[model samples]
Target: MGKTIAEKILSNHSGRDTKAGDIVIADLDFMIGQDGTSGVAIDSFRKMEAKKVADPSKIAIIIDHSSPSPNEGVSAIHKKIREFCLEQGVKLYDVGCGVCHQITPEQGLVVPGNLVIGADSHTCTYGAINVFSTGIGSTDLAAGMISGKLWFKVPETMKVNFNGQLPNGVYSKDLVLAFIGQIGADGATYLALEIGGQAINEMSVDARFTISNMAIECGAKAGLMEADNKVMEWVITHSKKKPNPQVADKDAAYKQVVEIDVTKLEPQIAKPHTVDNVCGVTEVAGTPVQQGFIGTCTNGRLEDFQVAAKILRGKKVKDSCRLIIAPASKDILMAMIKDGTYQSLLESGALAVTPGCGPCVGTHNGVPSDGENVISTANRNFLGRMGNRNAFIYLGSPATVAASMIEGQITDPRKYL
Candidate 1:
């Protein structure tokens, strides 16, 4: 009986031979707390009466959601987080730094074969680099901060194999959306999603990051990929840390195995109020849209910007539609600016937003109007996801978003591609 990557990593951290369903207290390699949720964590830390964090270097506090302080209350919370970080000497990433998930990997805080946790659901994004990362509650985050360890009920691995070339307009977002549609919202509940195959192996690190970032949307504990040369090289070039990519055993057990050939896959979209309520773009083509958003932790990388730029280079957004572009990080924003992508988007009538979570969390930046339809690259489309329950959110790839924004309706990106 061989072990899956999840089991292997947990075993290494727990100092024992572990497997699915096993209870183990594993040492955390890194931990994160973000502004949206860390306030409660800070309060809990005080309630626990801990003198100091177990290891300040191992922990990071990010202010992304509601960044720049959308209101006075949030400003006070930011003030508290800043004061606490200064007092405790813990690393703090203030507003404009970037989304926690994006900046953590960009800064090399996430690496393969490490067990990491964050107070945010999208913490699973780190698993793209072959790390065993997942989300924790505020109290659990506090506990990890204090003791530097957390217990886990090891999850069974669900293997998803993607073979064949992705169609020109079909990107990683479409693949993940199609997978979620097949599996349903709670399909992979508490299961580790190990994605691989020809398509995945050929995907860029940015693509892998997008796929892994949305694992939480489908109830996955973590979405992992085997680190290949691209991942190894990226991690090395980005951080001072050495890479130790993890691999599943040859005969590792999987709770379920799904094989998908993306050769003929089409652009996919997730309809309002649920991520799994997905369908091909054509299914809902010509559906009018009032706004379009092209950024988030899920799809706010430089690659995403490049794709949008390619589609909107010589076009402008529909007069009836408002478009917003938010790079995931300041670094990505700078990259877009240096490469002329930012100028192209601006000239195309897209409004520029700071590099942070911004409108993705519905806190500020670009919320939709009542009864409006918004096509976005951000993950999740539940009611009120973009600051108003009355507004509808439709999730799609950057190409789809860009094309639809130009047409003022949901349109297939294949035409633009």
Candidate 2:
């Protein structure tokens, strides 16, 4: 029997054959922790009484969440991380660097077929480029940091094939929302999602990153995309080393297969409270919104910003609504500035914040007021996700968020496009 991408990557890293449900100890190419989780991992590492990290170069600590120190408590945590990295010789990304998932790939730290783990749930974002990446708790992260190896239960694969071209005003975010709606929130619990097809292959690496970033929200172990020329080009541009692309065999075993025709798809929104509580844009049109946000690891790439700029140019954000734009990373923000997208957004009454998680994690910047409704491009929409238990968050694509920002309500993106 042939092996799926997850199985093959696990096998290669474990130095043994692997398949679904197999418990294997695999060597890690990289391990990451952000401010929110790294402190716990550090405590655990200290409790273990290890003198040195197994490989300092393989471990990275980022200060993204609560970046720039929202309060003294967060500042102390940042201080601890900086001190630990300095003492241990581990790579450290300071505040304003961006979300860990975005910076990890942008810095060329990830490569195809690499087995990566992080304390952040969205670590699976690396899988966008064919890496076998997943999230773990602080203790597990500490163990991986101390030993450079971690145990994993190989998961069964689910194959999702996207056929046909995506319609105008639709995006990878809409497709992912529609998919999550079909499968429900826990539909693929702990399963490896191997996503491909003409639509995925045709998508840019940034779009693929958006898709993979949300795999965790769907209750997936990881999301893997086949590494093709586009991925190779991205890797080459980001890193001096070339990737040895991994492709699933034709007969690879899959627990289930889902085929989606993108041509018939429309803009999708995950209504308040649950990511799986989805509906087409038209179904919820005219729903009032007090705020709109377009940023996060899931949809804060340059392409996303460009889409927002295209829609907001020469127009003003609704007077009743507040629009906030955050680029995923410093590079993306710089790119937007160079291309005048930032200026267009600013002129249209949108506020551009620093390149970081920014309101997505509810730490700081753009938190909603009580009883407010927000349309955002972030992945999750659970209650209190944006700092207030009473505020509601609606998830949509960038175009959808931008259109809704202009209308001060939930509106279909096609109208603006």
Candidate 3:
């Protein structure tokens, strides 16, 4: 029988054949930890009494979350991470550099057909480029750091195929939100999501990154899309490295298959308090919002900024709403500035913050007040995700958030487009 992309990648790394439900020890191309989790990992490494990392070059330590030190406690944590990286010779991306997910690919640290593990759940974001990446706990991360190998129980694959062209005002965020709604929050727990079809093929690498980044919100172990010509081109342009994109066998086994026609879809929103609590934009249109955010690993790319700029040009954000824009990485921030996207956003009354995971975890930047309503492009809308337990967060595409910012309420992006 043929093997799915996940199985094929795992099998290759394990030096043996692997299939669904198989347990194997696999070598990792990268082991990543961010400020939020790296401290724990470092402590665990010391507990294990390891003197040196298995491979310093293969380890990535990022200080993105709570960047710039939200408080003295976080600042001390950052200091420790910096000290550890210096002593261990591990690559460190300091505050304001960018989120780990965005920088990892932008810097060529992650590539096609490679296996990566990170202490952050969104590590699955790397799968956008056809890598087998997943999240692990601090202890597991420590083990991977010390030994450069980790055990895995291969997951069953769920194939999600997208067909037709996406309609105007719709985006990968909408499509993925619709899929998550259909499958429910726990629909694909611990299963590999094999995303494909004509629509996915036509999407840019940035768009694919959005889909893969959100797969974890639907309880997926990992989300994958077979790398195509576009992916190879992106790899070359960004990293100057030629890529060997992986492919699933022609008859790859899938536990289930889902088909979506993108042409008929509309902009989607995941209402406050739950990622799967989704509805078409029309359903929640006109609901009041107090804040708007556009950035995060999920939607903080250049394309996302372009869409927001196009919608906000020559218009000011609503007086009642506050809008904050954060670029995913320093490179993306610089690109936006050079392209005038940043100016347009600022002219429209948006505040541009540092390139980091600000406000996404409620550490700082745009946390909402009690009982306030927020519309953001970031993935996940769980209660208290953006600071206050009483404040509500609604997740949407960049266009949707921009349009709603202008209106100070939820509005269908089609109207603005």
Candidate 4:
């Protein structure tokens, strides 16, 4: 049987010629840690009595979720990880360098066809450009750090065959949210998703990133898109060279297949508390919003900001709302400044936040107060995922967020698009 791109990558990294159903310990190329559980992971390794890391340089320690420190426990955890990374010669990216996953790709770490594991579930986001990436528990990640090998269950692959043009205001987030909602949260558990077809070709790298980033949330092992010239070009523009790109073979089999036609879609929203609890924005028209955010590892890239900036330029946010923009990386931040997108957003009254995962993980600046409602482009609307449970969160694309900020209500972006 022909192997999918994900299967091929896994086989190559297994240090053996792997076959389906063959269990192997795969060598890891890169690993990442965040503020949440990385501290415990490092501590657990420390308790192992002089266990040395396989390669410290390949480890990336990031302080994002606890950016400004949500509380005493999280703040201390961030401090411990920072000190441990510094002491162990592990590369660290503190707040202001932007979300770890977003900056990791931009910083030239998440190349294609590599097995990159992280402590956070969203680590699967790196699969967008053909890398076979996923998240593991702290203990597993710590073990991988020392041994440079990780284990997988060899998930069955599912092919998503999307066809037709996406309607205006129906961006990548919309397609993915709809797909996962229809499939249910646990539908793809322990499975690899092979995304392809005309719709995948139309979506940009950032948009693809958005889709792959949320795959893990649906319990999928990883959501992968075949790498083509578009991905190759983005790789060239962002880095010196590209790694091997992989795609599923013509006769490769999938566990299941789904076809999505985005031609007549509208802006959709994942209501508070659950990503799968989705509905068209029109269904929530009277829903009021007090804040709008347009940045995250998922949607904080330069392209995402440009879309929001275009809509908000020469316009003003309503009095009831506070708009915030935090680019995904320092490189993206610099580009937006160079292109004057920053100024346009500022002129339109959006608050310029640091180049970090601000508010995305409910850590640093932009926390919403009780009874406040937030419309954000960040992934996940889980309770307390954005700071406080008392505050409500609505997840949408950048267009809907910016449009809502202008209208101060849950208005569909298609009206403006």
Put down candidate 1 lDDT per residue, 322-388, tens digits, no spaces.
9998899999999999999999999999998888897988889988989999999998899998899
Q: How do all models score by TM-score?
A: 0.99, 0.99, 0.99, 0.95
Which model is ahead, 2 or 3, in terms of lDDT? 3
Cα RMSD (angstroms) for every candidate in the order listed: 0.7, 0.8, 0.9, 1.7
Alpha-carbon lDDT of model 2: 0.92
Taking all chains together, the TM-score of candidate 2 against the true structure is 0.99
Q: What is the lDDT of residue 291 in candidate 4?
A: 93
Per-prediction count of colliding residue pairs? 0, 0, 0, 0
Give the Å shift of residue 416 in candidate 2: 1.4
lDDT of 2 by residue, 132-185 (tens): 899999999999999999999999999988899989988999999999999999
| lDDT measured at residue 123 in model 2 versus the true structure, 0 to 100 | 94
Question: What lDDT does candidate 2 reach at residue 141?
Answer: 95
Off by over 4 Å in 4: 17-21, 68-75, 240-242
Per-residue CA lDDT of candidate 3, range 199-240, in tens?
Answer: 898889999999999999889989999888888888877775
